[model samples]
Target: MRKIAIAVSLSIFIAFLIATAFLIHPFGYPPSEMDDYIIENTQSETGANNAVTAVVFDYRGFDTLGEATILFTAVTGVVMLFRAKKKREK
Candidate 1:
């Protein structure tokens, strides 16, 4: 019974993944409106020579900061989990 249930669940998950893969847009297409707007304005608006840097540091500053915070927390949690606990000898 357990094996049957596992097989059914795995089959459903795989089907969903296949359906999603087919729904995605094809590659090498023209940029979306938002992307075009960002590329056009990045240099003049942000005063950055590199558009990628301008987008990361100026346009998406808060979003990038949140990502950094999340990454730092994850690393700290992993480090704490693996750190050796000192034994107190009586």
Candidate 2:
């Protein structure tokens, strides 16, 4: 009985996930109005092959720094949690 209930719940969850994915259009890649001019000027002025990388790293470096700090903190927490504790002498 428990197995049947779990199977039914999992099937319903999977169906809901599939339905949601079909309803949402995840691949919409339309360019925004604000980026058009900046991108063109960046490529022309800076001669950067990838405008997106240039904008992300050069224009918004502070935001990237915050993201890196968050990643570092998470890694530190994981290391601390998994570190071997020294055995106490009797």
Highest TM-score among the candidates is held by which one? 1
TM-score of each: 0.72, 0.53
Give the whole-model CA lDDT for all candidates, comma-separated.
0.85, 0.80
Off by over 4 Å in 1: 78-84, 87-90
**Lowest-sum lDDT 10-residue window in model 2:** 81-90
- Tens digits of lDDT, candidate 1, 54-86: 888888899999999999999998877666443
51-80 in candidate 2: lDDT tens per residue?
888777876779889999999999998877
RMSD of 2: 4.4
- Kindly give the number of clashing pairs for every candidate: 0, 0
Assess candidate 2 and give its lDDT: 0.80
Cα error, candidate 2, residue 22 (Å): 13
